[model samples]
Target: MFRRDAGLMAAYLVDAETGELLDDLTDHRREFDLELAHTNIAGDLMDLDASVGLPGQLDPIDLADSLLVRYENLWAELTRSDVFDPEDQYLIEKRIGRLNELGFDVEEMEITTVDNGKQVKMVPRVVEHWHHKRRLASLTGLQVQENQARRLLNSLNRYRIILSEQEGRDVPLPVAAYRWISEVFNPSVQIIPHDLKGGLDDAELFHEILEHRWYLSEERHQDVGMPYAAQSYVDNVLRQRHH
Candidate 1:
């Protein structure tokens, strides 16, 4: 069980049975050997190498403390909010932009007017880093990066339009997503030759095809269908990667 200690700001590997830090793994050597010891906070375990021959040269407790301090400082900045001058309304936008730059998306925020509207207090209601990733996984069961999920959602929307037009009725989002995944995303990816995959995963291939479609549309001054763009990308770009 991994639990965060706010005061320590570091996740400790605890001995579940003793309810204490698993400081010495030597006792558990028979169960779990430490061949490649990995610790969080930018792999600070490399600092231990200098103490190979010395018993107390590298203190794990001190290392954990340092990591905790760094974590606390970073967590504070990302979540901190403050009162701003009412006249500078753009301050909120600037803060939101900074949050986005730090890989967080503000879903909602609470704003309060104080000092008779002379100041504004704004706090994020929901702060999340995996906004698009969560949405894509929930709707389509496809785990992907935020940008890739957003682009794929746009493609799914276009597919919905085609479905609605063909059926002459309103098509639900889930139904459209299912059809898009089955008829378009799945087949398009599965058809890619194994050797020419070029280390590209399914989500990456989907994203690249979407980009290829945009370029083809730009050149022709109209939309090039997904099928055409995908085939061209696989045959020309992916196949020629080794060359």
Candidate 2:
């Protein structure tokens, strides 16, 4: 049996004769070999790279220690009474934001009403928000980090709203998303000169562009268009960072 924690894989061997479980696979060469073969077969079936000894392999114990530290920090933050409030109208969004800030995602939430007030509890299923990634990929064909996907979605919604107002009609979501990808996102990122990009990916570069745009707009006391913003970011921010 194989268990995965924080991207580290651990295999448990079962004795064929006694039906006893062995915690360490390294001691038993036959069991280790069998398990490795099974893992390769599974990876092949799932269309994933099955190559052994890939880079960035972390010790499971070290991963667990780091995770424990994170969990402790999260617990400390959540224990504060001001962290969450039942009366807050935007409680759900705030809760999700807090979790996202700590590299966690809520898969399910439970709310209970008591004599004093309501209690909100979130069930964490994974470290990052895979659902957001999947949703964004399906809609925009962009695979990005959870926070990056959320930011891009927000930008897409804003674009859709503006388009709807300009056309004097409601623009469908899929159509708006496609247009945003082709017209806004793609063009903006494409204008970023290769030298100015540093080592950041497209999604990350776009996000930084958006942030730069907001800063420029605030500083200038006017809304500078996306194209101008992208160019300015390339010339100003990315150029400096690359140097």
Candidate 3:
């Protein structure tokens, strides 16, 4: 008969040999211990609820639209055709120039040339502009920046360089440009007041002034200094043209 005799729990089991023996212990697993283990198991089970176990749901329509837009843009960029005439060799450079102006650098291109001894033509197959503005800055030391900005600035700089040579004073190009901007371009525009800023942007206004000055110089058969050009342009043309 089984009975509690020594305040110890005992269980009968087969020993290492083929003989039976009684094992005793002072402490043993209780209902609470089994419940605690089961609680941990339940916590693990709860962690695997539907939200955690399920895959994410996405909007098919949105994803399809996004992919479609991506494909369209890529197709436009890669498939757009560029053509040129036999005499328009400069166009290739202009096309590459325009692309750079738009903040894009064509990395690779091959020019297909058609030669007939009398007629020669070339088409770009690969082209690119790389960190172009930065390179322009590093090399030129003057920063007008961006392709369009560089174009405008360089045009101004070229004229400035010519003006400096005409002056025969060894003045730096930037300084000359600054002088032209202040004396000729800016004051002419500013004279109209802030209410007229809408008629044209600052850059465009300056560009127009430059043109006016150029044609005036040609007409006079001499270099019309900024003072004469600014005064004449402001009174005769700028008021009628725009700010």
How accurate locally, in lDDT, is each candidate? 0.61, 0.65, 0.47
Estimate, for each residue in 50-160, the C-alpha lDDT of model 2 and write its tens digit: 345324753444444455466556665554332233333234444455665654555444444455544555655343325667777999999898668866765676566
Tens digit per residue, CA lDDT, model 1, 28-47: 55123222232442245444
Model 3 per-residue lDDT tens digits across residues 59-109: 344444455466556445543555544333333344444544433444334
Q: How accurate is candidate 1 locally (lDDT)?
A: 0.61
TM-score for each of the candidates: 0.47, 0.49, 0.32
| Candidate with better TM-score, 1 vs 3 | 1
Candidate that beats the other on TM-score, 2 or 3, i.e. the better one: 2
TM-score of 2: 0.49
lDDT value, candidate 2, whole model: 0.65
lDDT of 3 at 225: 52
Top lDDT: which candidate number? 2
Q: What is the lDDT of residue 196 in candidate 2?
A: 71
Cα error, residue 71 of model 3, in Å, equals: 39
Off by over 4 Å in 3: 1-185, 241-243
